[model samples]
Target: MKSGTRHPTGYWAEEFMRPHQAFLAEGYQVDIATPQGRQPVVDELSLSLGYNDNDQKSVDDQRAYIAGVAALKAPLVLGKVNAADYDAVFVVGGHGPMQDLAVDPDIGNLANAILSNPKKVFSAVCHGPASLLSIFDKDGNWLFKGRKLTGFSNAEETQATFAGERVAEPDATGVPDRI
Candidate 1:
């Protein structure tokens, strides 16, 4: 969660919920977590019907799915998570992550621990990738330095007119700078 009530885009949350639903259907237990184990807020713009991008059903489904999940109301504390207990880590995107996850040392440690497992898969989408900025290797370099990845780019945000607004940005530089 962000320091205050900052939140991620609603579309990003919906995108995450799709995979979460799939994993659950496949018998994978999904746990909602945050740096401080607080309930996450969703950006209002993301919930708008226009933002649904002509797929209102998807948004509706996501809302229904979220309503059924009790864990989202009060997630587990990220620092308390044992990486070994899960087979993978999925970071959901939203501007809110840029506010906290991007600079949170605990998130970096968690990512490092999860990535250290050869059998575990790590994935992030949209602004969710901002969390990657926190992970550093023993050499104090970015853990994902040479890896190929993509996320919400600054150009896109600029195109969307978020450049000078109050919207949250990443904590780093370039496409993934800190908010």
Candidate 2:
């Protein structure tokens, strides 16, 4: 999953992309989706690249997904997506999630549809987990209520960016109170 040109970096992006490879290798078909369903961008600032660039494991497993996405040249843009068709959904994270995923009505709708489907598995990582802002029911409660979950920790955000990523106040983005 991607949002705002879902860039393919940061701890979260790397985590989702690698498992994506394994899922593909095991014969599971995966589709990347994003708000606006546009191409996703990688935040070049994630420091993992500097030390790990040439390391074979890091190169093939992680960068391969980035290159793989690049080869496809476009994502399925989530805004136009139909979630009923997939058995699982993952939203990859970057600085972009706070910028885009949190407020898209479609993302909230997609998350609701996916989580409501009993067999479907939904997951996100790093700031990607911020996509949860959209996962609500008609009553405006999170669908994952009482379910164990994880998300971007304040400490992680502090470590990932040079300056604390200054998210505009929530009202500015129109995302819900929790994002």
Candidate 3:
């Protein structure tokens, strides 16, 4: 994607939609956010027949599901969101967060604000956890030091790379060794 040619990628459809559906079932008001306030793109690969167990209907449902989410059409910009306004922050995963959320300072600030408070929750899956690399204290210390965490695994990335998916390597200097 660096040669001025863009390969489409964003939130993994099942990764996002499954959690979104669960939240709605619980009657929670879900608000979507992106680094720059644009509507999120769905990782096309996530909707392919191979990923969907060869079910075209499943792929269609995922496409329709994302399109119907009004909040996703105009998601809040991460910098503009007040962490105090929400009880939890859920970061969705895909190839996109490796480029956006993982590198945004606002994500670090937001994570700090949410995690510092015991009443709030912060969670992410797959590449979404890459954003945790952004969490740092005012003194530049990693806030998640010594905490047990997991994200997209090296083996998984290696497999994706073999499958021709472009994966960016994010700086992990601030992350705890346990990650």
Candidate 4:
């Protein structure tokens, strides 16, 4: 989790939970990890009922999982993770990745290793793709250069109103530049 980034979009976290639960149901073990071995700080806005208005169950499930899951309570340190131990890597997006994962050398190396392996699957969602900025090819170019990708758009950021005020920072660099 990024130390300074906050106010993660609630919907994004909920989106991740769907797949997470599915994986668990399929008998796959889920391991939560962070750059450091500290508990991740979730944005308060993400915990609001409004985010899960249509399905209160989703919000309830998320809350229950967070409170009951031991892995999330003490996530593995990113630096200690070995790429060979996992078959896939899923990077969950929020405002957080832009702050730390985007530039963290350990995460960059891990993403690069996983992406380079033919048998391994590497995936990221929304702002999670920002972490790809740190991954470089052997020729020293961004690994995602020329690949089609999408994430939280500038328009969405500008249009988002939190507490009846525009949420995006006026001088905020667009997502492309941040990567």
lDDT of 3 by residue, 69-149 (tens): 999888899899999899999998898776687778998899999998999999998889988878898889777666777
Candidate 4 per-residue C-alpha lDDT over 1-179 given as tens digits, one digit per residue, 9 for 90 to 100: 12333444322565456677888999988897788866765544555677668577777777776667688679899988999899888887666655678777778888888988899988887667767777777766777766677766666555544221333331222223552
Could you tell me how far off, in angstroms, the CA of residue 151 lies in candidate 4 after the best superposition?
Answer: 2.0
- Local error of candidate 3 at residue 30 (angstroms): 0.6
Off by over 4 Å in 2: 1-13, 51-65, 70-72, 142-149, 161-179
**Model 1 alpha-carbon drift over 4 Å, by segment:** 1-11, 54-58, 146-148, 164-179
Each prediction's Cα lDDT score?
Answer: 0.73, 0.64, 0.82, 0.68
Q: What is the lDDT of residue 9 in candidate 2?
A: 43
Ranking by lDDT: 3, 1, 4, 2
Q: Using Cα atoms with residue i matched to residue i, what is each candidate's TM-score against the true structure? A: 0.80, 0.71, 0.86, 0.78
- Considering lDDT, which of the candidate structures 2 and 4 is the better prediction for this target? 4
10 residues in a row with least lDDT, candidate 4: 162-171
Error of 1 at 177 (Å): 4.3
After aligning candidate 1 to the native by TM-score, how far in Å is the CA of 52 from where it should be? 0.8
Q: Which candidate has the top score in TM-score?
A: 3
**Top-lDDT candidate index:** 3
Q: List residue ranges in candidate 4 displaced over 4 A.
A: 1-12, 54-57, 161-175
